[model samples]
Target: MEATLSVIGGRWKGVVLFHLLKGKKRFGELRRHLPNCTQRMLTLQLRELEEDGLVKRTVFPEIPPRVEYELTPFGRSVEPILVGMRDWGEKYKARL
Candidate 1:
């Protein structure tokens, strides 16, 4: 529904979550994985996901600083949904 779409419907949000499903990743790592997304847009999407309580951000105290993003317990609940979407997409692609 509308609520779910509102949280993950953006062009980059779902992609971001999909990457996070693999494991926690740093800002740079995420940027590399989603090469098409600009840094600013990625940052914005991450903030939104964090605000929605679906993504957790951890900041480490270091000279250069380190930050990592991972899914919250609630967020993990969506894994099956994303996997289903992935499966459906694969099927659709095959049909084509």
Candidate 2:
């Protein structure tokens, strides 16, 4: 449990993972999704997730290079947990 939290416990890490579960997203898209998160903080969180081997960063060579973020196979393994959390939160929120 500690290990799982260590990797995904950051303020926005799990949220990032949850969004990525939907599909690959560009940096701008992620920023839009996490509007409350500071750009620097999100950047830091992404770097940490990438370092932990849960997310993959791909850069395309182009005039205006494109970068996209998606989950690695290992990252996809956390789908159940993220989904469960989302479900539970929804239920809990409804109760309030």
Evaluated with lDDT, which candidate comes out highest?
2
What is the Cα-based lDDT of residue 37 in candidate 1?
95
The candidate maximizing TM-score is 2
Worst 10 residues of 1 by lDDT: 74-83
Clashing pairs in 2: none
Per-residue accuracy of model 1 over 1-96 as CA lDDT, tens digit each: 999999988899888899999999999999999999999999999999999999999999998999999999988888988898889999999999
lDDT at position 67, candidate 2: 91
The global C-alpha lDDT for each of the candidates, from Candidate 1 onward, is: 0.94, 0.97
Q: After superposition, how far is residue 2 of candidate 1 from its true place, in Å?
A: 0.3
Candidate 1 stretches greater than 4 Å from native: none
In model 2, the runs with Cα more than 4 Å from the true position are none
Scored against the true structure, residue 6 in model 1 reaches a CA lDDT of: 94
